[model samples]
Target: MDWRSVDAALFDLDGVITPTAEVHLRAWAELFTAALPPDVAPWSDADYFAHVDGRQRSDGVRAVLASRGLTLPEGDPDDPPGARTVHGLGNRKNDAFLTVLHRDGIAGYPGSVRLLDWLAGRGIRVGLVSSSRNARAVLGAAGLADRFPVVVDGLVAAELELAGKPAPDTYRYAARLLGVPERRAVVVEDAVSGVAAGRAGGFALVVGVDRGVGEPALREAGADIVVTDLADLIPTA
Candidate 1:
């Protein structure tokens, strides 16, 4: 990839920069397995990739529920964590995630941090575009909050009514915030939804980080280039 040609880079938060995707996966499994009726299949990683990963929390809850022929009220965002509504279940998952985060802090993948440093050295602006509402908290726990000047996270999306991943609004918003056009910015993501968003947004390049989703899947999702790690993009000194 020609790093010099891109004016900015947009990155996803969980699987792309940090391993918090594991934390999220565990939380979701616990929440859904406990809540779902025994007659329904238990939540699994496959379910997550298909219905939840890279989506907003409440949206994820709806998707997962719909997959299982279940439905819940679209409860208010302020609904308590244990409420039975969709927002409530999503909140419950958030609580579980926060407990894990506080118990065990997070760190960015070394390769991702290396790429961030390289981009900084090149004076290429970087923004975070994530469907996770806890994006700020995760970044703070990982000690990486200061690295990104623009964050188009779930909170921002909700406030602005911007569509989440699988839609291009958030990524386009991030690029605009960085004072760059979609065609001049690159997107780095680990989720198929995120890759699709980048492609839909018409980014100059969409680089997929294949943490577990597989390279072929990323390519099919519209990633221009797929790598196992962000360090693969670093230019040799």
Candidate 2:
């Protein structure tokens, strides 16, 4: 909770820094609802929170499939969308998300941007850690591509063989990139998995931005503090 003691801050991309979570939510709903058979229950927001939110694309697809007692081949990452495999389904979801992103564009949350500016003014280092492979593209669309010097995203996780959120590896990797120890850094997350990651990494502080995930859930997931907005953390000048 002591801001002065923190050397670096690691942030989650979609729900925390930007409102792309809604975009992701809609895309996932569309993909799964269309894929389900007539007798199968339609995909719902609860399903997204449980199986897809804050997870890698293919991993989310596999989890969702498992939930429905279905399984698919682990197709190549380069498999085209609609190829009828895990990777293909994930790719299809990505395509849908991209379509929405390109059509509607995106902007960083004002509170999040305010927090970034506050951290910058304090000379604190910043990094982005996200399970989304589209982190870069989303950041670019939101005009925040250059704000973070280090981004530990799904692409980098695959390259380094780091486990995704709830594992802490990506957050730890980002701290290392920022030349800070895990205990000297803070993590801002909006997802349960991400808060768990920060806790598992032994970071100095895990701040949860409760977008839709309840405050109690965030705390149970290991957040040291929970706020409705990052603006709450900014110091009065």
Candidate 3:
């Protein structure tokens, strides 16, 4: 399929564009390990690719917890960032991520940059939709904040009461922000849930970046095209 056929490109920020995705996974693993038990299998990259990345913070926390045959109360969204509940734990993970981001700074996925530049240069509208509250800061730190003309992130999601991944709301919002019909926009994602959301949104294309999501798994998630990286989609010069 030709990526250029789409009128606009909607991307998930973490694994799809930013190297900070790994930092997020590492922080999540550390936080989950400390909160859970040593006997529990540590959260692996595969697990993160499947369950955590691209998901909303509370949803990710719930997914990882469920993997351990455990459940936590769905604390109010108003719960303080560190109030010792499920929301608190999610906030803790965010804090860890911020520490890593501040210390290490931000980095972009080269493949993603290649694709974004190609898309932008061709005059295709581009937008970023992420389930992360820190998406703006991450982009700013990475010097990619202005590359995307539209950003619909976690804070906006919360403000609009949009459901996270596996729900079409976030991607739909992005398409609207880009002033493109959903059928004319493509959703580029690296997580299973994100692909599901794109499919549910009826996007013209769902390009899955199999960064850690195994090839077969992404195809099964309804990705219209599955590649190891976004560089695969760049039009040849």
RMSD of each: 0.8, 1.0, 1.8
Residue-wise lDDT of candidate 1 within 1-237, one digit each (tens)? Answer: 888789999999999999999999999999998989889888889988888889999989999999999999998999998899998999999999999999999999999999999999889999999999999999999999999999999999999999999999999999989999999999999999999999999999999999888889999999999999899999776
lDDT of 2: 0.93
The true-versus-predicted C-alpha distance at residue 95 of model 2, in Å, is: 0.4
lDDT of 2 at 25: 98
Model 2 C-alpha lDDT per residue in residues 1-237, reported as the tens digit of each score: 468898999999989999999999999999999887776677999988888889999989988888888888998999999899899999999999999999999999999999899989889999999999999999999999999999999999999999998999999999999999998999999999999999999999999999888999999999989999899998775
lDDT, residue 96, model 3: 93
List the candidates ranked by TM-score, beginning with the highest.
1, 2, 3
Q: For every model shown, what is its TM-score relative to the native structure? A: 0.98, 0.97, 0.93
Which one is best on TM-score? 1
Local distance difference test, each candidate:
0.94, 0.93, 0.86
Error of 3 at 156 (Å): 0.9
Model 3, span 1-237: residue lDDT tens: 576558999999988898777899899888876787677777676668767888888888888888888777878766766675789888888889999999999878888898888887888999999999999999999999999889999999999999999899999988998889998998998888889999999999998988776878888989989987788888675
**Candidate 3: Cα lDDT at 32:** 74
Off by over 4 Å in 1: none
Candidates 1 and 3 compared: the better one by TM-score is 1
Best candidate, lDDT? 1
